[model samples]
Target chain A: MTSDAAPAAPTNPGLGALFVGFLTISIQAFGGVLPWARRVIVERRGWLSPAEFTDMLSLCQFLPGPNMINLAVALGVRFRGIPGAIAAFAGLIGVPMVIVLLLVTLYEGIGPSPAVDDTLGAIAAAAAGLMIATTAKIAEPFFRARDWRAILIAAIGFLAVGIFRWPLLWVLFVLAPLGVAAYWRWRR
Target chain B: MGAYGQLIAHFAVLSLLAVGGVPTVIPEMHRHAVDVAGWLSDTEFTNLFAIAQGAPGPNMTIVTLIGWHVTGLGGALVATAAFCVPCCVLTYFVFQLWNRWRDRPWRVAVQAGLSAVTIGIVAAGALVIAIAADTNLARFAITLATAALAWWTRLNPLWALGAAGVIGALGFA
Candidate 1:
């Protein structure tokens, strides 16, 4: 039951490769990073197969913190231990942070203009749309699997967090266990 | 003891609790930064979130904005490091154990369970952001159109965002 089978031989990307790859991903990903990360890692680099990328992404998603950041660490460690991980992490975040700070400073200086506000408003709305589309894509697998229990749990989660506006910590504590138990029992 | 220490401590706790990623902690962050610490106003928080979404890189860049708001460049650096390092360290250690347990039934169960929950959480986040962003009919239309275009086509999302921005600049949306 070795899960290490790569459809193709895995390329051992060095720390520099990891850094540059992630840096490119960071620069190109305007609204969200995931799509660019997928393109660069899975498609361009072929460092991991599609299935491997999905599995890694699922694990990263399951853990805490930002999914992409966790992904950088996990992917980095997979290739070259702590230094590789740091390379990837720094590549993913460092330049972007500088840019964000610079933008913030520029925005502060500009003050509030109705035209700028209108543009930001439009961008925000489009961003929201992008989020909704992302959610649909994420849910597609469950929809394909006909996993009613999983779907139910997700629905309950949405209702609790979105509609009821319950605190996320409470929602996770209550639902995560139940969801896990259901899957556990079903497997048995 | 000092502002940096307080900032580090605050974000370190948030770092661990950021399940489903940084967006999950938006409300808590707002409460602490705005309601309690009095670091930023409600409008500022909303604008920061919006700007982060528009900017390139990870969604968590909002942490940098928050930190910048609190204590300039030093605050931004401290906040981002505190929020990320602990979580990355945890992930680094856990990834080994997880790969070892790759064949475990419980692991499968946990993954399956959590994937569903993740979808739900992401959906909830989308709803929250949509509500926050769509203040008027035109804004709402842009949102719906962008979503529909993204969902139905293979076109890149950037195009939609650009179009929305153009519409806004033209005062159409």
Candidate 2:
């Protein structure tokens, strides 16, 4: 008597799989994709569990790239290896890229009309507001924690460029290391 | 510099520093483009940055605007692709290796610093946008209100932007 047990099939992610994953990030995202991302990739889709997604997010926070983009690459690798990673990266940047190119063409075609100028100006104002709102909302917690150093950094950095008209790279060159050292001390 | 060289240099530098997005590089770009290269004036660059951000898509499109200023459409493509590719390559390898030591203290410091720098850069960008966009009191008021609305309400940014444009055209600003 002989008993045969079939070996388990390996889950090898392919380029196609990675492409699908890339598409997922783009279409799923609307306003932003932080908390919602966790929902889709982990809770809903089961690509990752909450704990695993959290782990990914934490590492991405430190990395010198867009956190979402970082996550997409990491996740792609998880599914399809390095090729998967490439696919995900391309999908994330490349998809939005086509739109960017088209927009530039249209911008040139529109030339400088009254409507165009006014629309652009209004959008600029709204963008300013967007940045301000982002700052206030994001900085609120840092303030509440009584982390005056970051606040000072923000204020000083702002004034350095906004008022003093110093170059940004110069200000960062002077401030970044000092800020890091000071943060190290403050935490201690 | 020749057009190709300038395009390559600009995008390459932008690629290295494009943490949090292109606005993080705005101040530096402004220094290089407006101050150093004499490519565009402060107001012109600011206006372009604002226009790019205010548009319905990715912020990287401003690279095109800069490209157009320096060397026209071809320049724009070169800068955009140059900026996009290298970063994409680096990101793949970095992410693959991150999990091995994700919790180290150095990692913590890096993230804290990145967010802070992003905040600082974005704040500066806003001020620049304000200066260029608010050519008059009404427009300035619109900018102020936009800021308030964005902070208080969760309204879509595009709608507000459209409304503000109408006001501007009507000479309300």
Candidate 3:
């Protein structure tokens, strides 16, 4: 008896899985989603590896938009197909976007109050810490490359803005090309 | 054609300025809405900004708050949608080709450039807020202390916020 060989089918993540993952991440996206997104995909779901997660993050950062939304789309597509990408994008952006609108409702009625300034001052200060944290966290990986060119560029950029008090746009314009040259030099 | 349009334009700029995230541009938004446009006073802007931060989700919520203050719920809609559109569209295209050139040359350069710019903008925002936060020694203490606590604490940042609130109640900035 002769047995016929069959073509293998393409396996894909199910729609239900996409719905659950997207909704879950969206609802929980407080403060930030990067940490949680990494958790759910790498740890909980086992969909992407640690290396893959890091690559996705870098891509999100390199792009010109909300890193969180881009991440959800990229990872979702990897796991659950295009439908999943859409689901994740809508879920992540849609949920928080809506919440912002709703909160705006009550925000206007607070009226004139000095207490707001005090509280916002504190919050703003805390937000600064987060920015500092995010910067260090993102830069930590690049440190392993040990590229002195990058170090000089970063230092120059920092000095221009922090010390000389140059406008941000001007610094970016000058330093962006310098960064490109430095990265090219190091990579080559 | 009106003040509302001007407000939306301001938010659009802020949205684009949201380099790392939304909070980095909070000071700019406050400056524009309260200081430039005169839509709201500093007290009014600060109060709304605080509520927006204390609420939840991304810091972009300030756009909606400013919008609501300037106009109404409709203003809120305009601000939120306008702010999001640029980021969304830009990210979508980025997502489309993300896998192909994840490690391409310009990509690496842009990422490096962004790190420096993000730090600069965030620091700028912080400086602006610090100046505004100045009330007296007590308030200045809250600002410096909160920065230190945040740096040291492994605890969630909300704790720092709550602590600062108590400090604020004591007539600090």
Candidate 4:
């Protein structure tokens, strides 16, 4: 067998495995899926080495749309092409979509009582706090690098979009290319 | 265009521009959903965001919830598909190309710069949601405490969220 020739060859998971893997990750993801994704894809399945998963994740993050969904599509395609991509995407979204819809339906059924409203409001506040934590976590890398230009750019982005309420499209159109150029010049 | 058509158009554009993730595009989502189209109120939007966060799934559940609120199951399906399909197709095609150019300096610089800006944008989005959600001092304090716990501790965020829910149920907030 070719196994002797290439001892390091990674196992190519079947499409079913791809679906099941993403499904498990989706179900376990309460606040976020990236950690669970790392566990399942790297430690549990051994489908991708830790380094490979990191590399893949970096690429996925750089792409548009949700990072987790992009990772799902990328991993699926890498292993089994388009059909695999479909399987993984479907698995990732299928059950969660149903669950969310059901919750919405339930909310609608319960109507808007004062106590229920207060509970949801409190939950919203906590959820917003989670968003704050997320911001700190993502910003940590910039803090470590002491990249002032990037920091400035980020600040400007926040001011323009978050505070001033400028249209996101216009703000990004101006900021993204400038940010790219600044980094390009510095590195060059 | 109809509401379904508008949902597709709006979310589809947001899909490609969601450089970091869904959170990065949330302020704009709030703008369109709350300010422009008048589809949902600020409180309704925040509630949906909280519900999606508390649920066990991807963060994109907010998008699904919004869709369900506006039109129904069909809207949910369409909104989700519109948000996901364009970007996934782009990812599929670009995966091989990205691998080929992985080591290039231009790619490195782009990643570094965009990621920095993405961080700022995400923070802003978080701030927008925070302002909408934290309407009073007690609620704001809960937000601050939850943020601290999430950032400093290894405990699951679900615990903090659950505690806040109980506090609310007790009529404390």
Q: Pick the candidate with the highest lDDT.
A: 1
**Model 4 stretches astray by more than 4 angstroms:** A1-68, A75-88, B1-79
* Cα lDDT of model 3 by residue, B82-166, tens digit: 7776766666666667556666887766565555444444344455455545546665665566555534554544565566666
Q: Could you give candidate 1's per-residue lDDT for residues B140-159 as a string of tens digits?
A: 99889978886677576678
Q: In TM-score terms, which candidate is top?
A: 1
**Model 2 — interface RMS deviation?**
9.7
lDDT of 3 by residue, A77-104 (tens): 6666567777776666556656765655
Docking verdict class for candidate 3: acceptable
Off by over 4 Å in 2: A1-110, B1-10, B17-54, B65-78, B92-99
**Considering lDDT, which of the candidate structures 2 and 3 is the better prediction for this target?**
2
**Residue pairs with clashing backbones, model 1:** none
- Local lDDT at A99 for model 4: 88
C-alpha lDDT of all candidate models, in order: 0.83, 0.61, 0.58, 0.80
Candidate 2 local lDDT, A73-186, one digit each (tens):
777777877777778666655555555556656766775577666666655665565555545545555577776776787677778877777766567667666666666665
Which residue pairs come into collision in candidate 2? B139-B173
- Ranking of all predicted structures according to TM-score, beginning with the best and ending with the worst: 1, 4, 2, 3
Worst 10 residues of 2 chain B by lDDT: B110-119
Q: Candidate 1 regions off by >4 Å? A: A1-14, A28-58, B27-50
Candidate closer to the true structure by TM-score (higher is better), 3 or 4? 4
True contacts kept of each: 0.75, 0.34, 0.24, 0.74
